[model samples]
Target: MGQEINQTQFNEQAFKEYNRRLLNEAELLQTQLTKRCFSDIGEICGYELEFWLIDHNYFPSPINQAFLTRLNNPLVVPELSCFNAELNGVPLPLRGDVLTAISKELSQNWLQCQEAAHGMDSVLMMIGILPTVRQKDLCLSNMSDLKRYRALNEQVVTQRVGRPLRIRIQGRENLDINHPDVMMEAAATSFQIHLQSAQRDAVRYFNASIIAAGPLLAAAGNSPFLFDTDLWDETRVPLFEQSVEIVDEANLENHRVSFGQGYARESLFECFAHNIATHPVLLPMLMDTSPQQFEHLRLHNGTIWRWIRPLIGFDHDGTPHLRIEQRVLPSGPTIVDMMANATLYFGLVRFLAGLDDAPESRLSFDQARNNFYAAAREGLRAQMVWWNDSVTDAKTLFMEEILPMARQGLKDLKIDKADIDHYLGVIEMRVQSGQTGAVWQRAYREKHQADNLQLVAAYLEKQRSGAPVYEWEI
Candidate 1:
């Protein structure tokens, strides 16, 4: 059982005490983790993609009850909402052309989810944010009936009292959004990829991922608009940060949480220390006195902060493994598209870990952060600055530089050639066509101005019909 902390109860004394405890706990965890063998190069690799659920009528359904009653597979897991379900693929070793294996598994999982959705008249769609997710729908009433979900929601909102969250974005157009509850966070859905490597290489991989994130995200943009408004290239970027931000004047003066602090050091422990130091735990777990408590520590770490999360799991013989799970990507319109993103990432990690780039001081962390923001703001249309001395459009970078390097990297790893070509080719085609999920959604939102406010139903219908974005009939 986890103890849920209320933000309102946090005073200066409590804040100091909490930080003090977190620092001590982190030190102990670090000492224990350091003594164990954590792989420095890539060994284990995996992904987790989440989707929003809809019924035949293209409306948000309370049909999770029916779907769960029929779902029996171990892989089809429950999410925070009855209207959402998650599909976790098998973990593959980061060896011998994993692209084909990952693609086959992801496609199979999607197919399984589709099959489970059939009898219940539900469908799964991958968009940055569901177009029709209404403000009213974000209430506690609409939340999934799970203790964890409710506990998290209560903890976040209670910390802020009844004040609506403050959200502002500057893009092609400026927008301000205010929501009284945390339900607005539910509007966002994403396909997050997790790459497992040893603690030593964590910083290099994490920073390299940040550098490539802008172009990769722009090229793979699946979310262009939200609530029928042409906002950021991937609106979910801002939407997610805003929805989860729990700011009180007192807490703001003491502690704060944002997308990231900046670039990372050469070790994963730096990130763990940062999280433990900066962010206070919202949910608390009761201390269980058991010899198996070490196992529980790993599980709790997984459930903490979404960005740059610390992951600890065991291997076949119960050997504890430590890795960082990245939680800042949107789910995709195609499996190949997802694989393309993964390939570039894995390549960058391998490339960076082996090469010693100048420290975070020389490479502007602000530039990296801005680059990702630029991508979210402009999609493929954005101009990006490379880490090396060159400036190029995101599409050009992906088609010529990034994609080929990704292929080479995958090849070096002996990943299946067919899988590499197929997935990388999808990314190439997406760049040439300029029709990422976000591009299509933006076009549709523009063409259907009259139906803009229909948000959920309209978008759900278009997505469920399995039609191309251009060919979609609203």
Candidate 2:
């Protein structure tokens, strides 16, 4: 969950005052960056994953308030709609057997969430999109009873000049629909991985994450169906981009949610400054907290959903630190699979960021951005341009080059040898077998001529067995 606001409504005066504070904080952050005042601590791993609550009929269940009350865990919290919730992991130092630790903790939390939901005759699911969900289920009536969510709906519609949200996607099949509120966003969920980097390496880490996003998503495409139509292998990507559209009369590239304009050159503060100048603040909730906490600036940043987002966090000593959030992956096929994705991400970023000649220097920002879209559209078979500027399918690149680089990267991190082999091996098998979550779903549907409900049922059964996607059968 993001920072909660005391009130859902604001006046023009409040907006102006909030803007004043936001700009001041950005300037202060830039000053800190210039002075190298940020904390030197680095290499911390964290995550926030979004999940769905489903009834026995395999459809979205609107019972999160009751479910959360029974679960009573701070790590688990309500999401945009009553049918969804989010799970956050404790921050941990990234070394030794940390990947295994993540798998264990996430599995335990997932099991507990299921037990809580089961008490009310509901089951919890982790996926990019619940296929059985209907347009009627994503209405305002099902929106979470939270002031922040409602405020977002009001602000987005206001910014769009009351034009309905347009969602037009073309894939193996085509889908065109209009939604009246921001609730369409609730249909897509994701697994966000965080990296707390040393202040010296922040810019490099952010840029490296941008370069790795395309291939990472190619191995993790999980959402392929929405509203009974076949769309992109990772339909959530485009769905999310369209769901939160705000009218830009200036026609700027900032769309509230995007891949971003370009990689950072000098400091991550460039992102905050850009936010202050170009992106209109969505939730201008005023805070009485000390300016040192960056409350106003963070509140504004939370509303703009970048695929690779730079984060500001404070240590226990009140020392601010920089972090990079990798937001391109989907929620789940299984706990181990998510960890495998995490392993690949950490390794690739470590290797790419440490390169004497930065990978970003070799791969242009346009290629990185275009590669991401292509992978989202075509999954593992998508052709990608490597650092050598040679074109190859994502599967071929993963098999021939990316996996070796990831292994060497993890080794360089001093991560335990067994953990490296286990997790990366999972990724290797997943790529070679051509069995990402999206591919599995499409295969099941095409082979058995199964309805969406049957496909979801089979998926849930396999997911319950706690096997990775490569091992899951249609």
Candidate 3:
């Protein structure tokens, strides 16, 4: 979705031609993978953090055009809504002091973004969903002024046969609403992490990410309230899945934005094959690139929003590489918290990938998918089924099993002990204290009778203090 398209208008002939080329590229990619023609890159880490733009009164502010123009930084880009923007980080090798280095870069970039937002009389906020954002604030008018976004809205609505998108979420409170455009997706923001891996290890890492989603999300759950209705601890899960809901005509049960049908059996290329076979082309723009570039394949993959997406990229020398993008974590209670989440994820994934037997072999894909939604709905309190078919609460699983594995994984990666201790320690305290961003927000709302704006104000205040979420007072 980050890539831009030249033409938005599409006729039947154009769509057919584009789809043909897309499949051709997919075939070429498959052949290349079979021949092991991709770059053998080591572990590389990066992230894209999404944030909301709000006014002084803590209301959704649709001023990103001016705000971005004033900011004028290449790393910053517009999101689905004008009230949202994303910051991308430089990919770095995951070793030694990499965590600290990335944290410094993110903090500095955030400070610069803050300065630019202030220049436009708006403030930047890092949250999964802004508590003050109302239904009125999510209209099409608030969508960012981008042709790709406009085209996406048109394509999704057309796929739905012009029916209004229906969203029904049941939690402590129920929310059922109808939306006209994809703007409902703009309501949620996230901190997405990426890890580049060799083709041989990509599938294992991707599956490991799926299994890790439950405990990781429980430890980092944010976005607990949407439109003043108390919902899932990580409401963004269902919110995003349903916001642009599309069902496959061939398979009515299959959804475009989903937790995938099953695990990758052989290689990550199986995912691309599944994508080519199952999903219809959402963006059919033809690019003037060779089959080796896989432009069409990349664009088609972008439209399918997998929680753990498989990505193909190129190195500095134009050698193609594969990456696993972890899309589960929410944006921020603090930058350190975001880093902590990334640390725990990288460590756990590395540990899981290095196991003698694949974790997915022991745990069914159904169980992994169910555990994810359970954690999203229940946070740390969620009970998850792990290896050996044992069920346990997320907190106990993290403390007794996952955390130690993460520590060993970091040590195996040769990360500095201080860096590992500092970041993983944040996760340790968060689990022990049972205080994540979602917990703090719920606590604040309970005390203040769910005053959304005041809650946002308090959140921003604590956010600016540069304290990890566990240290913040509710």
Best by lDDT: 2
In model 1, where do residues sit more than 4 Å from their true spots?
Answer: 1-24, 33-36, 39-41, 248-257, 289-307, 356-362, 447-474
lDDT by residue for model 2 (162-280), tens: 99999999998999999999999999999999999999999999999999999999999999999999999999999999899896524547788899989999999998888887788
What TM-score do all the candidates reach, one by one? 0.85, 0.99, 0.98
Error of 2 at 470 (Å): 1.0
Better of 2 and 3 by lDDT: 2
- Comparing 1 and 3 on lDDT, the stronger one: 3
List model 1 lDDT by residue over 1-474, tens digit each.
122223323346654554455555566666765664554445578877877777665556655656766877667666666677677767788777666778788877777777878867777777677666656666667776666666666667777786778767666567687877666667777776677666666666676666666766777667655655567878887877677677654553223334466676545566666655555566454333332334334433433544445566556665556655656668766555567777767765565455555434445776776778778778888888775546888878777677776777677667777776766666677778888777776666667753644544565566555444434443
Q: How many clashing residue pairs, candidate 2?
A: 0
Worst 10 residues of 3 by lDDT: 246-255
RMSD for all candidates, in order, please.
4.2, 1.0, 1.3
Candidate 3 regions off by >4 Å? 248-253
Q: lDDT scores for all predictions?
A: 0.64, 0.92, 0.91
Give lDDT for model 1.
0.64
Two-way TM-score contest, 1 vs 2, winner? 2
Per-residue lDDT tens digits for candidate 3, residues 1-474, read: 298987777889878998899889888888888899998887999999999999999998899888889889889999999899999999999999999899999999999999998887889899998999999999888988888888889999998899988888999899999999989999899999999998888888889999888888989999999999999999999999999887633553457788888888777888888888878888888889888899989988999999999999999999999998899999998999999999999999999999999999999999999999998999899999999899999999989998999999898888889989999999999999999999999998898875998899999999999899999887
Per-candidate total of colliding backbone pairs: 11, 0, 0
Clashing pairs in 2: none
